[model samples]
Target: MSISMKLSRTLGTAFTGLLLAAAISTTAQASGDSVKLEKQDWSFNGIFGTYDRGALKRGYQIYSEVCVSCHSLNYVAYRNLMDIGFEEDNVKEIAAEFEVEDGPNDEGEMYLRPARPSDRFVAPYANEKASRAANNGAFPPDLSLMVKARKGGPDYLYGLLTRYQEEAPDGMELADGMSYNEVFPGHQIAMAQPLDDDAVEYEDGTPATLVQHAKDVTTFLAWAASPEMEQRKRLGIKVMLFLFVWTGMLIALKKKIWAKLH
Candidate 1:
């Protein structure tokens, strides 16, 4: 089928899934908070609490193996590895995995070597057209900055990966170009659930569970989206410490300056 046709189908499926999810949400709200198996989403600072590190690590593995084939994280940098807890050697080792080409100026410059610690993760395809052609005109999005781009990003992403379901036996009506994503826009998605527990080796010793893998990848992607996370955290800490010290000095200065005046 044409790329447009496939995209239309995917969009239709997504729309329906969204509507179903909205209806379900409405019913739950009207019925009050007595629903079973409350699916709590992970967060950096949750309405419930923090996200899991092991989950994030496993998620990175999953992305490296599965989704990376179609999506690209162009916005992430090679140096951000330290924030996600990779050491210098591991970071360099990771950077060396991808070969990036560079060359000198117009004077018969020599080509650069393999990818370094500073280059972004390469896209699986060159551009949108290329990506679409490969996936029946469905544009596999660049994922580097996606977590920041989308609403409820991590939660949305995590849920989407795990929400594939079997369609009802009855002929289900979907949009012009969508599929049934029980957890997607139309509660039906054209892309099948691309993952299962033990989809990749859980090198971190985390249990081989779908939920665990999703969460980990989400975290990794989150870091990839903002390689500056560690720096941000460090800056925040330094700012806090500076404020505390500065406030103490201000109070002491005030006491000294007001002593005789009072």
Candidate 2:
């Protein structure tokens, strides 16, 4: 056999072995011992994808009413809501809801004042120590980069929010302060079930179901993790188009130049 034929067979065998190993790893990850994250259809998924304004708004409401008590979005500001289609007046009203620490004028003492658009989201606790003390030593994580930090991203968040069970499976004993969640790592989590049906009234008349709240909150977190996603995708598309045109022009020029030699 020719050298090229032998090389092709060797490459094909390596690729087949790689695919089999991947399949085995995936199967192991999906076992009962491991967490199974649910798959979700996201609006901001593709190259041209943009956030759903209504969903994002509802998500903000969910995060505010439910997640805000424990988790903080330190990276987000009221002004950032404008990118999600919030009006300037509404952003101001929302900002004013929180009281932030401001500098003293001449007394050299800090004073509490209503938040402004420029202020970052306030934390329930003043410091990490306080946060851990409040939650029985398990620190509540900041939600700003939670989506990007997690392995499964939005799907993991959605599944975790909606996958809580009242009782653990038979023969599994849970420790104090721990809750049962099949989707959570080790099937145990420190946080209790934070969401429920009809937990919050939706202004858009959508049913405040558990799944809806989970999905909306997940979408909001996804947006928070990548606020510039839409702009980046747009730029990427433009770059790809330019490269395609450039490549075609170069190929045509090459053919025209070589034709003279022939």
The best candidate by lDDT is: 2
What is the TM-score of candidate 1?
0.67
lDDT (10s digit) by residue, model 2, range 1-262: 9999999999999999999999999887777476656688899988898888889999999999889999999999889999999999999899999999888858999999999988888888899999999999899999999999988999988888999999999999999999999788888899999988998899899999999998899899999989999999999999999999999999999999999994
- Best-matching candidate per TM-score: 2
lDDT of 1 by residue, 60-132 (tens): 7788899988888887766765556667887788878777667765886866566777888767887888987
Clashing pairs for predicted structure model 2, backbone only: none
lDDT of candidates 1 onward, in order? 0.71, 0.91
Judged by lDDT against the true structure, how good is candidate 2?
A: 0.91
lDDT of 1: 0.71
Provide backbone clash counts, one per model. 29, 0
Backbone clash tally (model 2): 0
The CA lDDT at 242 in model 1 is: 99
